[model samples]
Target: MGKHRAYKFRLYPNKEQEMLINKTIGSSRFVFNYFLSLWKEEYKKTGKGLTYNKCATMIPALKKSNEYSWLKEVDSIALQSSVKNLEDSFNRFFKKQNKAPRFKSKKNPNQSYTTKNVSNSIQIQGNRIKLPKLKMAKFANSRDINGSILRATISRKASGKYFVSLLVEEHIQELDKSNNSVGIDLGIKDFAILDDGTVYNNNRYTTKMAKQLAREQRKLSRRYEQAKKDGKKLEDAKNYQKQKIKVARLHEKVANQREDFLNKVSTIIVKNHDVICIEDLNTKGMLRNHNLAKSISDVSWSMFVDKLQYKADWYGKQIVKIDRWYPSSQICSSCGVNSGKKTLDIRNWTCECGVEHDRDINASKNIKNEGLRQIQSYDKIG
Candidate 1:
């Protein structure tokens, strides 16, 4: 089987290259928005949306127009890829996997454009990458590019950092089989509680940076007000723009910290255990509780599970998700008895089987045993 992976590296473009990169970003955004407008109009007039091929065919005509002649300045493949992304968005919306596609905004902090590799149009030579229009842009090149590059996505973050993510096709060797298995219980108080009574505390990166974030936001708000008082648009205000970057950098810092922590924890768990079991949490529904929403979002339980899943796939490990309604917390792990549901306040409970249980630990143990039972049943049937 073919394995796909993406490697992202920071880009350092010169003054001319930076201008070209910005132009490419703007052109890609314009193409996406223009086609989106046409798609909306066509659907309204004929009750049919535009397909990828149809949109792609319109690109040449658009570039030929005097008003949109600038579109030809950027990479043609990038524009086509943008339309393809729109098609993907529509498909996802139709399948109920995501919301309907929205128009791309120039003011949006996240800007990106993707281009494919056609007969080695995209290549990494030493510390620089040769793009279609922006040639030989220098990158950090911290790691060697592995496998064949299929596509590359150039992106600009809110912090004004440029990055390129290369999607490559490669072969991955599965890790050796291990005998150990584990169950994980995720919570706001603790990041993860393992079946073996190991608890990983939540790092709370957002909360840790909340004070600085608040201060920076306040500064941004003040700048906006000053800009309004001076009869200048917020976008044209230098102080407001500077403050916005500051706030964005803080937000990016917190996000990076959270991602790093999650990667390490997931790697440790996936590497140590062969069979991993976790709850299929309804994160969307859980977020409805306004009181714990911030805390829950800060912990990012969903992201942790996502990392675990991909790592498990890569490492030839097994991941089983038990139903959310399985009452692992309320059941007695020692005896096959279901104790009545207990409120969250009851952290410890004594079951009728004369077993004292710690709520999270006991739940994890139950999850592990139940997951093993499920695997055993499947094996017997097979």
Candidate 2:
């Protein structure tokens, strides 16, 4: 009944610990890139690549050298994890699931390194967390974590904030059964419409802050252009770097706001319903229409679906994703008559059976009935 989960906490490290964390993150990135280059070179020459164990064993000799002796200053387990990650990347490439591994750059705003919990190297007590090399850094213990620690990934963000996400194995108790079921129709105007006529409006955070974001981005662009005209490396341009952080802060605010909204909505729906049904929307394909792409992206349908699925799993609820091609909107929920496709402008229509229907509400009802039918075909609970 136990599953692996990750809980992320904001970290407040002292100056010395912060320096060490940065060094560790850099070292891990370097290790991954170094091994990736070696593997690609070897494959080019002999049509073979180095295994993870081979790369891991070579770390000791690397740390002994003067050039890479700094790697020894950070946590060793993090280096091993780096090699392991490279192995996974190669595996995925060979499996045709991903592209070849690429080199990591320090210019990247986000950086992280994973380290395993060996012999109790990681621990949590009070509002402080014990990490390897950086021991006992204070963190925002907003929620209690009750589980056995497996590993921790420390990351630094563009806003110059550090965080740690701990992977833990634990049993999550299922929520009490609400005995309620509902279907959801996701749309651009209203984020979600339930079968029961409950509608959740799409609060477009991007449009709300569009003007401010454009202003800050203009500042960042000016700084970059000035640095380029002055013949200075963009990374070394103090003004540009400072402006980048300001722009990133604005983006961070929008992202946090969107995430908070999605989390609250998904949680509320899952906690109140036992069987949730939805269409398996082709959000990627929907983005191809330039006219509606901005609206679709602002709604963030995919992220909302992902949240619903996971929260449903945690709460022992069911999520039934109906076929994308199902003519939920075309079919009348009352008469079950397939009235041919209607254009987007036709928001309300009267069916041949003389039943008037709202586009989204009717589709949601059909989705719910279809989901129940499918569940019944398999002799499962609705």
Candidate 3:
């Protein structure tokens, strides 16, 4: 069996191509919203629901009957995919895996429809990528993709940056073999403290750009307020849309920067270690802490761990997630004594056993030992 893979490209489409992409995105949103509304109405009236396959089958007839000839402009497969996404969302909601369905807004929907397993190759000559509908565009890098392109989505961010995300399918290559293993402890001070005594400081991308972002946001807010007063707010207003794009571009820049950093860190750790251990953090609970809220969100610790886990799998390395309730930080790595009362501000402490411990580093060591013990126990059981 092959692995499903995905890659993203930062597209730099020309003006003409940009317009086409914008139109495609708008059309896709229309179709999705139209069907979603229709489905909701049917559910209320008939007490029955439409399946994605049903929706896909009905689209051509619906368009012909309704005189929505513009629907013909977008690829049929793309339309089917969009319907399938709705189906999957509903399935997940019914399964209690996700929240109830919500309406998509036109202001920031930033996505459109495209198909999978077709002639959807975006060429890369040097640093440029060729986008369908959109012409040749430049990118910062050409990812080593290993799958057929499924969807090509062009999006404009709050910072006015444009990007294309590609979903693909390919077999995953096995990772190299090694006996080395390492443990990771994630904390507020450092993003991760490894068992090998390395501390990767948390580079809070959003926090670092806070001041500049705030300035841009304030500008956007002022524009919005003025528009509200003058009744000048219309979706198609050129200046209003331009400001929205600016705000979106900033948010996008921060996200891109964070993703890049996480990818590099994950790649390095997976390549260097044969086994990795990390805590299963309760990110939702962590978000509730008022004092550390912004810092925690800016750290994107959960996303970092997610990247690490997936990259480890792709590289044939093992990743063990220690239970969140485990007192990795409170237990002494050397003496096995519980110091659960240690305050959060206490960065370092000397144990009664004369072991000097940096809180995070010590926690990392403890976590590593626990992971090793679990592995050994599993081996014994087998």
Candidate 4:
């Protein structure tokens, strides 16, 4: 079966193209929020929400209406996509899969709109891609995209930069298995610990840029106040906007650095190991501890795990997740004796079986052993 993949490229649109793209994005957001409001009002009045078809059917009349006539400036399909997204949101909310839909905010740092590929409206040709309304725009074209294009999503980042991600259907060949297996333990001090005793240091990208970010943010705050005092709209405040972009760039840099690190680490591990075992961590639950919340967010354990799992799937590798409550650290890997419990401060310990262990490495070993045992047990049952 073919796998779906997305290829994102840095986009460089001209001034006019950017204006049109922004208009399209704003129109989509307006459509989504407008329908969301109608849905809420209907539900409140009669205990029933607006259906997708109902909302979609109303769009033509909406565009013809004098107040929202500007909606016709953007592609009609993008507007319909917004309605579809709203319907999906409602379905998920009723199914208890996600929170209720909310209005889209214009002040959000990231702006995006998804557009379909009808009649090959989207095509990559020689470092440029043709898009609806925006027409042909230049992109980085760094990698060769080998797939039938499904849709394209154009997004603007907080750093005042634009990007386009192409979703495509492709047949991906699975990698040959090496029969190698390993276990990993995740932590704050160290990003990852493998059973082989390899330690990946927690490169705190946010911490590294903390001082610079704070400095720029302070400048932005002052400019914001100046704009307010002058009775100027924040969007029209040139000085304030400039400062805002600077602060945003710092944040963008930190994010890019973190993503790069995660990608490199995940790729290396996936390539080297066939069967990867790790704890099934309840990361959201773990974040409840205020003392560790900030640190955990910076570590981005969930993002790292997601990257690992997806890559493993792409390479035909297996990822075994042990129960979150499993006493990986408490049990001594050497003698299989439970030491009961250990504090976070206790990084090294001596087990009763004459074994001195590095806590993370020991836990990783236990995870590997437990994962292998579970596999064997499952095989026996099968």
lDDT of candidates 1 onward, in order: 0.91, 0.94, 0.77, 0.93
Top-scoring candidate (lDDT): 2
**lDDT for position 102 in model 4:** 92
lDDT for 113 in candidate 1 is 91
- In candidate 1, what residue range of length 10 has the lowest lDDT sum? 169-178
- On residues 165-189, what C-alpha lDDT tens digit does candidate 4 reach at each position? 9999888888888888998999999
Please tell me which model should have the higher lDDT, number 3 or number 4.
4
RMSD to the native, candidate 2?
A: 2.1
lDDT of 1 at 363: 93
- Candidate numbers, best lDDT first, in rank order: 2, 4, 1, 3
lDDT of each residue in 203-266, candidate 2, tens digit only:
9999898999999999989998999999999879999989888888888888899989999999
Q: List the residue pairs that clash in candidate 1.
A: none
| C-alpha RMSD between model 4 and the true structure | 1.4
Clashes of 1: 0
Q: How many clashes (backbone atoms < 3 Å, residues ≥3 apart in a chain or on different chains) does model 2 have?
A: 0
The TM-score that candidate 3 achieves is 0.89
The TM-score values for the models, in the order shown, are: 0.97, 0.94, 0.89, 0.97
